[model samples]
Target: MATPPSLSPISPPSPPNTTTTAPPSSLPNNTAPPTPPVTNNSDPVADSPNGTFANLLPPPPPPRSVESLPPGTLAGLIVGVGLGALIVLIGAGIFVIFYRRRKKKLANNYSGAAPQGVDPQHWQQSVPQITVLPKPTPPPGITPHLYNSVEPPSTSTSLGSEKPSNASPSPVVAMGHSLGTFTYEDLAMATDNFTDSNLIGQGGFGYVHKGVLKDGKVVAIKQLKVGSGQGEREFQAEVDIISRVHHRHLVSLVGYCIVGVQRLLVYDFVPNDTLEFHLHGKDRPVMNWSTRMKIALGAAKGLAYLHEDCKPKIIHRDIKAANILLDESFEARLADFGLAKYSLDTDTHVSTRVMGTFGYMAPEYASSGKLTEKSDVFSFGVVLLEMITGYRPVDKIQRSLMIA
Candidate 1:
């Protein structure tokens, strides 16, 4: 061999096997850690004491149910639910009680019940009076008391005696004497289909048409304006109030017709026109002083009757020359009860909506809606100024007739 390099390669000697002991500080003091047992890849058995996984997982948690709840917790939940139900029931009961009380109070107010501190007996015994200046001498042939001779019709011929009609009676009839009820068709025929030719007047509430009924009785039919915000209730209230009142100086309600939303009131027709026509109309003779005084007195008497004679006093809210209707004999008749209001005898002032002609309205009533009998009296005084001065209460140059 050593004679020539051997063609075969020789492997390097492997390092001699060496064993070195670790330092005491670096080595663990206890015995060597035990090796973990290897799990068999193909084994289906569970590694549990009883050869099942049930023990490995905590014994399956107890089934979830309300029964698992603690005794005190269950009782508290029941008590909470009961308390909530009780509270709801109590609130509903209180609401119903308050609602009933408020409704009853409103009804009493609307029905004009006697107010607190008012003695009904004492009020009945007393005669209410409207203070007035002494009256001037009346013109010849005209009686001093214009309406004294006129008597209310007997009960036999009153509205209560009217035969029942096909149309149902309005609730307004119950408040006063029963009134005749007419269908819309009956009224249409009487007024020739509400033609302009038959139109007698127009005002805030509606148009007035002259008509002749089948019974040959002449009447003034008032057709309330559509979309005027006036409804069956308001119309019924007006009819109820006016029907109960009967006076020679006051307009009378003959009957009323209701068709759907349409409301028509029938009244006895006055032969002559309104007092405004005679006082301020063109081509009219000027009213003399004595005639003016007579008119003033008559109107005052009517107002006084409304304010004093009525059980629940009526306030003629709108008082103006235009509202005064004249008869053939020039006797004054107060018409248009649309804006009338009822006032309690014990009330100092009735709070209401500010209504009435501009110049005729009292300053106190116009500024504040507190109305009283005195408010009507103030309007009457304005009318007196109009009669005396022969000028309009409100005019282009003078907005209001100021007292000197």
Candidate 2:
């Protein structure tokens, strides 16, 4: 009987008419329900049984595209991109302009062209140019004016007693060789009335003070002691010789001032102190070997220039260490031409009054006052000895020995 029942239920299996769909909870929030693809088979059951299921689904969102965005949204995006591009272009332009301006400013601050016959690399430190002003006319019988606050002595004792024949009310001279002539009042303002605080150096010639002109130029002003006929002659000689000479190793003569008997010479300021100061100054570090060599070479070149290159040649009567000044780069500049002499071509030697530092004086010059280029060379040799041994030419130890 069980077998007969099983046979009765063996009818053809009906085709599955319905498909099951996943619950809405099973899909991600951002994911759309996947649509069943349309097929060519005309099976009613395979498609949705009623149009209700298709209606519940959105009309497959009108195929999304960029053109479908709102007008306002598209315009905002275009404007934002354009503004970003413009800002970048403006920043680039500004940087270029600033770079060019900085480059031009540096070029403008550069000093004058390098001196002739000098190594450009060695002469990197630029020497500022001195602006030579026009010579001014002077009043007759010009009364000398003191540039400092110190009260002038009575007319009888003042430098007026030794006034030069060419002296005039105007400091400027008509001579072609004269440099820029400064008024006594102008120099007084520059040197702070030649106060003791402004003194930079002191020597047999006079006292040197630092001065700054109205135009922002720095200079060394040497004021010769009054009532010394020798000093007056030295002043005249220095002005005449230095005004005509120009070389890289020589101290440049910027200008000169002659008020009454007061004689002052203006020279380019050497920032670094004199060789003597560096070598023997209290509280100063000992100069390194390299710097000493540089100074020696530069001084030699300067001395050679004076003896060989100058017209009729020159004799630096005082070639002591104190007369060798240094610049920012420690370039030696031969200064203090007060004792310099012009050697005549026809004369073998110049017989002059004994002058020069005692220890640095040559034997011939000290004995017979016979000055020559060789005398300068001899003094230079003593300076070389000082540099090598770091010994003062006339120290207390040497003086004691001489006394004994």
Candidate 3:
């Protein structure tokens, strides 16, 4: 075999000269010295005993490809995944907490406080607690009595002979349930003998006066005009309808009085005046768009409750602007249920005498005396027109008149 040529040792090339600078006195001299750079003579082929050309080049740059990750890289990936999972878990926990709190608040609003004077034992007993009605579902298995042919209770039995002036009038139990009752004396005293200053409003049937009961509760006392022809029927009808139904949008019946021939209805006093007053009263500030929209929505909801929720749905025979009263918060409530009539599920239209404000009556109801939920809708439309145009239903000056 021929002898291989001897390889000569190679010298490293000199580095280019750079100006050296001294550290400033303010800096410390504990810094480590710079590392010397490897030269061509430092090849693995020259250093190793079994050297080959394969070892001459650098050791393949320690495999920088993704497949060969560094030790620290794997640790960093695991730490990053753990941190992301922790963040997601924390976010989920926060969302669940907020949702539960909001749900509880809504439940409280829908379930209002029990009415004053409700017997605790009776409230806790089998009688189901009255909550804001979401829809009118009749009491389970209970037949709703129709008032279509209900005649006025005879004078002898209706209000019963007036109790002697010396004796306190006995409380009258409601037909289906126990409700508060007032004597003529009790209400007369509350209203200061129905002075003109106590009068809040007047309607075809009666005058409404603000009164304060002995229990410190404010009430609206509606004294029906004697011999109004329908006073007796209206009293019974209103009691039957409002006693069994409870809704946030409807005026709550506090109690009723039938002393001798005088008839009166007590209701929870709504602090604000009628929608008519705000909409048409002179020198009153214009109702803003938001407030007007709120009123409209609330009134629609009230009618919806009567038409869609009640078992034998009710048709608000009178849905004029005057009947829509507002509370201190400007919440709209449907008042005056004296003319409200029930429409049985089996009946297409209740055959009743036409009764409503002059210009707010529906044409079909006025001409045919046929009553249905549509009758109320027609009146509601007229009220909506009034709200939009800011005009009375019967504006004699404008020559604008709307019936039903």
Candidate 4:
């Protein structure tokens, strides 16, 4: 009977996985609400609408457009992006500039010692301590003027008697001549390579030439060729001796040029020729009596300047008519200092090698070579005689010496 009940009461099982939802547990009480009464006033469709007609109330004003946001939003976003990129670029640029400046500054920095606060471009000179030296001392025979220059006394070296007498001459050249300097190129260009056409005169030590400078300034150039004639030291001596000597009657050395082996002296060019040309040339006028007297006085003044005014008495051993240069105004000047001899080196006369022209030399200097201030006086007398008589000293001496 049980078996038969199972078969009879069996129903198909629910599908395997399907789920069904149940209503809420809190169910409302079983009560009926009264329906509202519908009053018939006019056609329903005309009075009020429902369903699709009610839904068509302009579709709820079509939802607002998202792109129509407030004014600042999109602009703010774009500016923010641009500002961010600018900040990144600026940061990178600043970093690069800092590194480059630091690198360049370090590269330019120098560690070597230099003068304090000196720019190295201006006052950059430095005086190192170790480079200083003691002043030099003079050796024997260097101070030749203190005693006889040629023959030192037998006891002089042994005794070393350094004391001097009261009447010692100063070493200074006295009132000094105003001197000028010229560029070496000026002389070369002026003389046109020391041409023969420009040659005006010649001497034992040098040659003279007339020249015109680039500025149209006329000048005379005395080229001193390099040799051991007076020795290389003579060139320096000539400049030193002449620079310190000044007299109205003496020719003024205006400028000089020295380039290696070439040495040139510059003088104010005299427009007129030498006195010898006028005295000897037939075409030229003979010098007047007053002119000759002035010339003699000028020569005496030049000699007086050399002998009395200067510290060391200088004797122009070769004074002659050829050496007397004249200007356009006939003003006289004593020229040719290349053969000048000086003495009174110490407290007394310091004699060395005896040298002079034949006719103008003193009798004492010519024979024994023992010269003094008196020797120059004798030579001056000879020149005076020559000027007064208008006769050459050589001719007179030749005539007199042949008398025996």
Candidate 5:
């Protein structure tokens, strides 16, 4: 009770007039501590006093790696993509083009042959074996019957009374052979209106006129006489036979023409003239033995080709000196296929009307019209005799002394 003031102070006051604030832990157990305000370091706007504007704004994007990329990178990427697409398109286009071309080539190859199980005659009429070029529109009444095999002359129909309407259409350009087609006006212009001044020679079929073509080619244009049935038959036979066979010693057909009733044929111009002209002309030097033998051999080779080499062996019913044409080099070119006939491999001989030059006819052919390769051999022998003796086949004074 009687303690000193220095030793024992008041319990709540360390000294007189001190502060009364208490620490948080010294607070009563029933009272809770107050919460402190939060501060954001990452977002300065959110850390600011005005938090309403910070809530409305979107967060800033991450920093772009612009320095990591090379220059022109975007443009190069676009160009690379475009080039890749272009290369793919070009490759596809090339494939399509090659496919079409190969298909066309195969089709063309297949078209040139006869199909299995098909009739040969029907196939011949429909599709020929030769390659045909692009053809222009044909004239009226002209059918697609070019290269049709000629009917044998066994029919009793007279050649003198036949009309043009009854005859088959002559070979047009690009039909069954490689031949040019010309209009009547074009040929007339080429031959200077087909004047008699341009006439080079005449034959049983027509008159030949030497002319310059539009291409500056010198050709012999054969103008057949109109309204002659024999002429029409000759035209058909020549076109059918000559267009197929090809030999160095055979005349080449350049082209043909048909306008109204007019019929014309074009052939390569043989500059030297006919063998008949050289052998029997009015005033000409005699041909040497070597030259005559050479001509004879060449003519023989041509005849052999017609007889043995041709598919359906051709029999030149009129193989004579007048039909053998000579070129600049004296090479023989067998011309005038008007009277040619086809002898099948199965048949022994082709029998028909007796027609040919008188002296050159074989005895069997002249008597019974039984034409054969032997007949040609006989005629060839007669021609050889003429060559040896320098005498015409039917000499006026030597009628009784026949060599063949």
Candidate 6:
């Protein structure tokens, strides 16, 4: 019951070469074209350019089909699916980033919410309101107070084996108003009617007089010239600017009074004279290098504080030796803020009228009115060089050169 194997395909053998006497009409009997005669070693199929391997023993197998895939196709499928998942993950990450940015922008515009760090409680700011409280009514058997309607009942026990009756209302407390405001007449009387002996110093705008209050406290009172709006403006500027500044080297303004065009500025009085006096006095001893360096450092620190530390960058337009005052400890304190300007808006040099002292002005600032931080630096340099040389910037040679 054994089965037969299939045989390989073969071409028909060629006939032997011979001289034939058959008629040409008999050629129709042979349906095939005659093959070339075969010799003892002649090849039936010779090499040709069209196809050398057409006569090969077997043809190649059919191209593999996906449905009937090879044994290792699962491994390829796994790798392809993993790559597709990675691409999808990257796409999702990009979408998440854009979504977060859009959400954050929307939240910033309104009642902001979500995983953001902003506190939701302060997101909606409500307008403030002013509320008035009603006073409570009096209890039974309590008579209304005289002169002060809000006064309370005062009851005291004498401990004499009987409940003591309420004592009379405090007469002094019931008499005067609680408003402790000090009037202009009071200040004038406390200052001894503006006496000349109280005069401590005179400035460009007004005179500074020393005063002693009834409580034995000393104070400096800056009195503006009567009926001078310019002096009043300067006084107001001093109060508004220095009141907000809190610095160790800056002079502090205490309180002020504006009485019928008579402007007054009060400050914590400094005990010693200005730096210009100490450095320029004839009988005063020459300042040593250490003392000069200390003064210079103090002035530089004050300038730096004004420039960087202040909320609004303030420029001390008249930062000269005359404006630096010394206290009882010889520590430098910046004074005379009348010409100060705020430079918060720009670093560009400003054009201003020449308001500074002559030898201290920068050449460009003096010529073209271009004032900047460099102008201050130049003024400081002149003061430092003057201290080192023991000569003023407006001395004989300096005046000639400056004039030239």
Best by the lDDT measure: 2
Q: Candidate 3 regions off by >4 Å?
A: 1-176, 400-404
Q: lDDT tens digits, residues 282-388, model 1?
A: 99998888888778888887888788766667888889989998888788888887777777667788787798888889998999999998988998888888888
- Per-residue lDDT of 233 in model 4: 35
Q: Give candidate 1 misplaced runs (Cα > 4 Å).
A: 1-176, 231-234, 397-404
TM-score of each: 0.56, 0.58, 0.58, 0.51, 0.60, 0.51
Clashes of each: 0, 0, 6, 3, 0, 0
Report the CA-based lDDT of candidate 5 relative to the real structure: 0.72
Which is superior by lDDT, 3 or 4? 3
Best by TM-score: 5
If the candidates were sorted by their lDDT against the true structure, best first, what order would they fall in?
Answer: 2, 5, 3, 1, 6, 4
Cα lDDT tens digits for candidate 3, 369-393: 9999999998999999889989887
| Runs of candidate 4 exceeding 4 Å displacement | 1-179, 231-234, 345-348, 396-404
Model 2 residue runs over 4 Å out of place are 1-174, 398-404
RMSD of each: 22.2, 21.8, 24.0, 25.8, 16.0, 21.2
Off by over 4 Å in 5: 1-175, 397-401
Give the least accurate 10-residue stretch of model 2, judged by summed lDDT. Answer: 150-159
- Give the TM-score comparing model 6 with the true structure, all chains together: 0.51
Query: After aligning candidate 4 to the native by TM-score, how far in Å is the CA of 117 from where it should be?
Result: 48
Q: Write out the backbone clash pairs for model 6.
A: none
Give the distance in Å from residue 218's predicted Cα in candidate 4 to where it truly belongs: 2.1
Between candidates 1 and 5, name the one with more favorable TM-score: 5
RMSD of 4: 25.8
Residue 387 of model 4: what lDDT?
61
**TM-score (C-alpha, index-matched) for candidate 5:** 0.60
lDDT of 5 by residue, 57-76 (tens): 89889888756556589789
List, residue by residue over 1-404, the lDDT tens digit for candidate 6.
99999998887888667676554555665576666556554332454455555666466699987676676897899889999999999999999999999887665533213113323431221111212122223222434332111112211121012111123322122111111223345446556866888887786778888777666667677777765545544554464346445566777666555333345666767777777888886799888878888888877877776666553456666767777877876777787665555554345766666667788878888889776777777877877776677676776755555421
Give one digit per residue, the lDDT tens place, for model 4 in 55-158: 55454576677567577897998999999999999999999999999776544332212223323322111111111112222222233122110111111211
